[model samples]
Target chain A: MKGRAEVRVMLKDTVSDPQGETLQRSLVSKGYDVSRVRAGKFLQLELTGYSREDIVARLEEICSDILSNPVIEDYEYDLEEVLE
Target chain B: MKGRAEVRVMLKDTVSDPQGETLQRSLVSKGYDVSRVRAGKFLQLELTGYSREDIVARLEEICSDILSNPVIEDYEYDLEEVLE
Candidate 1:
């Protein structure tokens, strides 16, 4: 079976986001009414597996150990079966 | 009125994503069954506006002119009203 995953990796609330802050400042300077901005990462993955459970288990490990920094980032994913 | 927007900015299919390629290589080396990976940016925005229409109009501009490089990237967003 084949699967597709859409993952979002974001900094934890306790972590300071300097990039987001800078962007907010820039946007404000340009006269936009934006009050806050947060920047994060989005990843789309295509995987091959024998079963849905197999893929989910692997995805959990991959998201935690490789896709996000456990100390400062949190990751979430949506997985769906792919016809191909 | 207050609003929030979740925005995704992705590279066009024609543009190569080196970062994603590198990550895919690293994951494969670790024995993952991943086939393809594409990476992009996610942004969360908070804004103040008079109405949903007002916010939507500004969001469209912000996404295209500021958040994404029109030549190589494309952006999409979802907007929702928030209670203050």
Candidate 2:
């Protein structure tokens, strides 16, 4: 079955997030009155020809191997069946 | 009250996502048997001194005004109370 998967990849706690820091700075510069801005990445995939279990397993691998850098990032995901 | 807010930002349909395309190519090259990779940005904020409703409204403004470019991107978010 065809399906959609959403993978959210984020910097691990020990990693330095320059991008997030820069964004926070910008927001503060604009006088938004906010703090503690952490940023990450989100990926949505259109996956095909796999059962739900297969898709989940494959996606988990893809997330760890390709979607994120293990030393610096972590990931989570959601999957749903989709119409072809 | 202190709370956490998650914001997901993505390119609009009309925008070209070179990063996503490049990632897709890299995944394909690695023989992942996958297709259609769309990527976006996610942000987690540690916000303070606001009611749930206030936080939601402020975050909506922050997302539209700073976190995303309306001409080319869109965003969504979830907010939850957190311990200080």
The top-ranked prediction according to TM-score is 1
Specify the poorest-scoring 10-residue window by lDDT in model 2 chain A: A27-36
TM-score of each: 0.97, 0.90
State the DockQ, from 0 to 1, for candidate 1.
0.88
lDDT of 2 at A54: 82
The DockQ figures for the candidates are 0.88, 0.67
Per residue, candidate 2 scores C-alpha lDDT tens digits across A1-84 of: 887888899999788888888988887787655778888998888776558888887788888887889988999998989976
TM-score of candidate 1 versus the correct structure, residues matched by position: 0.97
Candidate 1 chain B lDDT trough over 10 residues, lowest sum: B75-84
Shift of residue B20 alpha carbon in model 2, Å: 1.5
Clashing pairs in 2: none
* CAPRI level of candidate 2: medium
CA lDDT scores, all candidates in order: 0.93, 0.83
Top-scoring candidate (lDDT): 1
- Model 2, stretches more than 4 Å misplaced? none
